[model samples]
Target: MRKLRIGIVGTGYVTDCHYKAFKQNRNAVISGMCHTYNLSHPKYREKQESLKKKCKGFDIKAYNDFNELVSDPSIDAIIISSTNSLHFEHIVAAINNGKHVLADMPVVTDIKQLAAIEKLSEEKGISIFPAHNFVYNEAMKKVKALIEDGRIGQIIHASFLSSHSISNNHLLGWNPNSELSKGEAMFDSGHHLIYQCLYLLGKPVKISSFKSKTILKSMDCEDTMQLSMQFVNGAMAVLMQSWSKDHSKMINGIRILGTYGSIVLTDALYFNDKKIMKMNDYMESFVRLSKAFSDNILKKVPPLSDLNAVHEILEITSNLYKTAEIESLRII
Candidate 1:
């Protein structure tokens, strides 16, 4: 079988992770990469030079523009790791050019753009795989299995805690910029835990949220978000996302309570408070997610979810964000 050729857009932190993940995949090869460099900014010169070195080391082609990358017949797919705001146009370009896409999360800034993306993919017979990497974690996969096997019986409540520390680089960059990132922590990196909850428990019917900037006050956006959800099954979930804290052990951890038993996870597998299995490094989740995307493209396995599932998550996320507008946010 011919290996899938991938072109990566936006050569940055998330792109670096995707590159490393694809390198470990036997079914795919990263043929090239390109970023729509902000030529107006003198700072991007350093970024372009860095990308040149990366391309040389990997022995892959680098396009000067996204159009060229998507137009290359040698590349079978493109990874859209660009800014949150640029995802829509990038994905559309790839799909129109017959290239499959693995787009990073908060895939698009707006919920209205999702249906058009779905329509384009269907018209082109291509896949627009969302980079919802946390759900691919072995521990998360195990949790889904346990819930289905009745190990914890019927779930009553789920709590997801994301206390990640943002870097000085990202804080000074597009992440905290409202017009660029289109959101704060909850809809950004925090999207990991949000999607994982939805993945394990299914979509929620009701969502209420509060956002505040307790830390990282240099930025205009909120650094902390608290979201409460009510599922149709009558189960409840509470998510607390904080860019203010730097707790590595507590990042993306969850606790689930069911009728018969409960589970608490903080970097290790625990069932009813008994440790069952140790987990792998967090980077492993990205690799596993890449493999899933590649295998699905190869028709060797079914996708974790289809385009509709992606839309559902985006819709719920949009609704959740709308519930807490900038005016309501407390900037303490």
Candidate 2:
């Protein structure tokens, strides 16, 4: 009945969501948090205080120095929720520190870093679980079962659209250099679509994509991205993600198409779709993943998103970015 001590690297908005989820898990404890940036910033400090207050029984220390958090002997696992660019270094340090890691999605923007982490995790005998929370969605899980059980026989073709407004300020906050933001949409939003695609159709053999900055004049990252994947199993998937869409009336969603039936999950895929599946909101997907990781740490079960699947998703994403870049050249 020992609690799993978890250290989180990053104190951003998404990290706060993670913190809240960790607090809800009775089997997990938020041991500490690290942020290399200005933790003294009012919003950042406020979030730290809020988390501390919320996780009253947990020992949550806020550190400006990430190394200090990584070096903490009390931390049994680390969650890498840092920015896309810093994921490689942070994850490496966590792995070397001999802690199980739950890395946020788009694990690393670069293929080299992704491969290195895969190798390092194997060498260290520590597990690295990517935060592809979609796979744990009750509806998606049901859909997966339906497909597997022949309720949806032979998944023919599928499409996914994840659109949201990435305000100018938000883009600037992440990448001061406009060009860098222009390049990260695929890494940011495309990762989710690709992960879902892999979950449904297995690994893709060839991926072709078109990415461009369609709007948001000040932002350099491509606000729009369209990817077409040809899975090794002969199933094809088309994925589109955009940051320029009008979010006032719009929301994110996915559709899985099969010969017998189709499944649709919208509005972050957890809340909206859970009701459709007649499930409770208490069943958060990250909580499931956290429990799964805890079980794996206790040697009770294997990691839910195994290394091979993680590698395949990372590879597909990296390749899609490359394809997008090539397509960009052809367009020019």
Q: Name the top lDDT candidate.
A: 1
Q: Write the per-residue lDDT of candidate 1 for residues 164-262, one digit (tens) a residue.
A: 788988887888888888888887877777777877888888988888899888777789988899999899999988898775574568899999898
What is candidate 2's lDDT per residue for 1-332, written digit by digit as tens? 77998888766666766776777777888778766454556676665565556445345676646777888888899998876677788889989999888888767666677789888989998888778776776667766776778766777777878877766657657753533332566667667777777776777677898877777666655778888877666777888888777672344566666776666666433321334454324337767767666767776586545656767866776677677777344454
Q: Cα deviation in Å at residue 107, candidate 1? A: 1.8
- Taking all chains together, each candidate's TM-score versus the true structure is 0.92, 0.82
Find the candidate with the highest TM-score and give its number: 1
Candidate 1 matches the true fold with a TM-score of 0.92
Q: Relative to the unseen true structure, what is the C-alpha lDDT of residue 315 in candidate 1, on a scale of 0 to 100?
A: 77
* Candidates' C-alpha lDDT: 0.83, 0.71
